[model samples]
Target: MTNPLGIVGAGIGGLTLACALEQQNIPFTLYEQAESFEALGYGIQVSPNVVRVLAALGLTEKLEAIAHRCYGFELRSFTSDQTLIKWQLPKNQLYYQCRRADLHQLLFDGLRDKSKLNFATRLTGYSQTTDKVALKFEHAPKVEVAGLVGADGVGSPTRRQLMLDSQQTKPSYAGYAAFRAILPWRSPYEELAGRATVWLGKNHHVVAYPNGNLNHGEQWLNLVLVVKESQWQEEGWTIEVDKSQVAAEFQNQSRLLNQILKDMIASPEPCYKWGLFTRPALPFWSQNKVTLLGDAAHPMVPFQAQGAAMSIEDAYVLAQCLQRHQTTEGAFQQYENLRYQRATRMQITSRKNADIFHASGLKAIARDFVFKIVDAIAPNLMNLKSAWIYDYDVTKL
Candidate 1:
């Protein structure tokens, strides 16, 4: 307990782990490569499962104050221009769509001592022993700790280093990329602000929802346009786009979809883009006192919308086991045992959704027919899938 636990990456998973450890009075240090945290990215949905963890950390009040509570989730058809299906969100205890930075800040400020965070100190290398481990960074001297965690994200250096002892690994691209726009929420768009809508098409889908935290006082609809691609050579989370180029891609879809895309294009903001990536479930999640968390363990395509939620779940469960088990190995083993099956299932489900969402020809026809019948017979059938995800409370793990 004397040596502070070393955590690499200050992302949602890393931040959540740090906060959970602090709540349990465990000393820890969080390292981030970024010089300073900036507000980037678009809307993120904090579903019921994740909110339970935040509520445990005493962040419910702050979170509810900033995020928009989701009223319902509707999936619409782009070809037919009709509502394919809908699920009414539970009363007041529904899902929330918060700006990514807003949630990060909530966890960031929850730390008791700001000095515990070391920014601009990237992980360069690491070595471990039975007693403790040493962490090397790009900008500073090495530090040793009882345990080391890789919450750095998909390209986690900690994961790569651990992989040296086992199977070689790398993040694989999904041959598709997403373009995002924060359209100004005003006048005509005002009425659609709070609803979470998904427009399903032949080879793509669009997810749109309003977030009130774009500019100082302005509101904006966060639209994510996901389409198939041949190749992407981008290096970062966002990129510049020729408005006409984006428009041309979606011109074949519905008129409503086109109008929304056009308005988003007219906005002054440059479109943010990132390639969707996927990876096989790791052979394992732990090696000695070093282990993985979040995307580092199981990176998946974003079809399930559980990327962040699963990470939040991992953070809580990891901290819980680490607090109880006497040895780091036992703690990590239990953590994986509790999570591996469920996490793998989620990856499979999310990946399968891509095929379903992007269906064409005979596949698309059968998919629509099945959905129509389900909507007629059991309207709430699709909503039940959420209980497996949203109903989980990691604090009780």
Candidate 2:
């Protein structure tokens, strides 16, 4: 029998890719560094672009049970406390808001061969021959497989080994970080039920939405507060910090902002902070029988909320490419060809949104004015502009 493909890192992207491959009867061995899967991460938006992918995997009904089906988006001015743009989706279009752990569990349950999972196996590096690739793990035996995939995330060792000299592999601080919390929902906030609200401020922005419960009985609300920082070199998502740090950053902002921060502080939950980082899109992501997917290939800032969506999209497409092409090299080439351009565009656009969302003074005024003009003249204009993002269906490609 042919050897199973080696998937490094069991993140959402890796697990999604594995589940896709399993559907096609493709064999794979999934390696995770952690000893066991724990409920990590605050919340994530499963945008319309990726909802189709989940449906294809026969996971839509399960997702619906545990996710809040968001109906639309609202962009508001932080200084003025005024709604700038409000747009809703058609009934057919589906957008979900849920805890990242819940989404991760959903994908994990979708996988058939749980026995293929490996734990406490930290990938150190890898080397590839003409036909097979060997994955090196810390204090563990090197395993050889027909192909290798790097879904190990931003600090991916697989990505490091694949492109040693490429400048794109290095990540630079994006001058900001996010303070995230998942607060239990006792009641609904204004426009936060079944909708995502973006509070745009000078050098900062806040996104809040209802996150469906994780069998904890009470519903939850997810909050991500992005603030500009002069110096913060660390990059991680699960670093716990005091809520006072978040309060100090936005103390001079709006009253609503203060209230939100107060509620976060009052809640028993802890706030986690992670520095935002970005890397240039790689001109190539695969070499020989080894390749990359998700943040391992292209890491982006969260300004556009497409970071996870892009990875999920990459997972399905890469699985398709591998199933179609007989040779691993051929499959890697086709996957890169189909994904590079679109993923690069997302990276660039996401960076641009950072500037747009954090506009100041006259630029902020102009930004609000443009959205107001579009809202009044053509309310549907926002929906029309985001069509390219939400309308993507990877199954059609």
Candidate 3:
């Protein structure tokens, strides 16, 4: 009998890959360090590109039930109460804004081989041979895998080991911090309740959209503030912070923006923040039988909101290659060849967006001028600009 494939994380990318493998009757085991799943993370956006993959994996009905479909966004200036760009998202393609924990549960429950999943199994290290890779967990005995996949996310031990052994660049801090808040979407903020909005400022930017809890019958709003702060260096990590402190960070913004930021956590619970980080797209994501996926391979800043979307795409494309190619070696190569360019482009463009979103002085003027021209000449240019990303259908690939 063949050894089962090893998946070293239960994140969005990891579980998605596992489900796809199970759908095809491919043997695989998932290792998760967390004792149990929790809705701990912040908001997550699912673009049309990833929705197509999820639908292909038989998650269409489930997503339709819980995912909040967002049609467009109104980009506003932080200093002035003026519209910068009114982008009407493409109609044919669907986009969903959701709680990360909610989406994680949906993916987790959809997996077929729960019997093969191991929780609280921290991946300590691994060793690879000619035909198999051996994984060492903190508690469990060493397990051999026919092929190894590292979906462990940024600061991945698997990636660190691979780069250390092969002499490659490690993941580095992206010089920004992300403050996130989730709270009830109630009365008084009617204008901000149901739509996605972006507030662009110098050296910082903010995004807010509607998200809800289907189980609890609650309406909520999700806010994320990305700012340049190099003084505190916390690499690839998130920590609990005071809600009042979070409000103060954005206190100088417009009245509406300030009110929304303050109300994001009106409850007693605290808010949280994390340092954003990334690594240059590796020249090769796969070496021998071991490979990297998702944030483990290409962690990007959140400017384009495609971090999870790209990871979902990676899983779908890799699964297709694995089923199509007879050998794991050829499948890995084909997967990288097909996916590397797209992932690299996403990483680079995400960085570019950080600069574009936080432009100041002459740069800001030039940006707004271009936006005005585009908004006037081509109102749907934003949709057309992202057609390559949204139109991607991995099932068709």
Best-performing candidate as measured by TM-score: 2
Q: TM-score per candidate, in order?
A: 0.95, 0.96, 0.95
> lDDT score, residue 125, model 1?
88
- Angstrom error at residue 233, model 2: 3.5
lDDT of 3 by residue, 1-397 (tens): 1898898989999989998998888788999898976645668888888888988999987886776778787888877857878877766888887788878888989986688788889999999888889999998889999888899998788888878744456766788888888777666556764458888888878898877543445567788888888755554377888777777767654777788766764765467788888877787789888888999999999999999888888988888888888777788889999999999999999999999988999999898888878878887888778888888888887
Candidate 2 positional error at 309, Å: 0.9
Off by over 4 Å in 1: 165-168, 213-218, 252-255
Question: In angstroms, how far off is 166's CA in candidate 2?
Answer: 4.0
Kindly give the stretch of ten consecutive residues in candidate 1 with the minimal lDDT sum.
211-220
Kindly list the per-residue Cα lDDT of model 1 for residues 282-313, writing each as its tens digit: 88989888889999988888888899888889
Q: What TM-score does prediction 3 earn?
A: 0.95
Candidate 1: how many backbone clashes?
Answer: 0
Q: What is the C-alpha lDDT of each candidate?
A: 0.82, 0.86, 0.82
Predict model 3's lDDT versus the native.
0.82
Candidate order by decreasing lDDT: 2, 3, 1
User: Which digits, one per residue and each the tens of the lDDT, describe model 2 over residues 1-397?
Assistant: 1788999888899999989999999989999999987656779999998999999999998888889889898898877778898888877799998989889999999988899889889998888888788888996799999999999998888888888856756877888888899787754365478789899989889998988843444478899999888778554555788898787777644566677788899999999888888898876899999898999899999988898898899999999998899998999899999989989999999999998999999999999999999888877777877888999899888
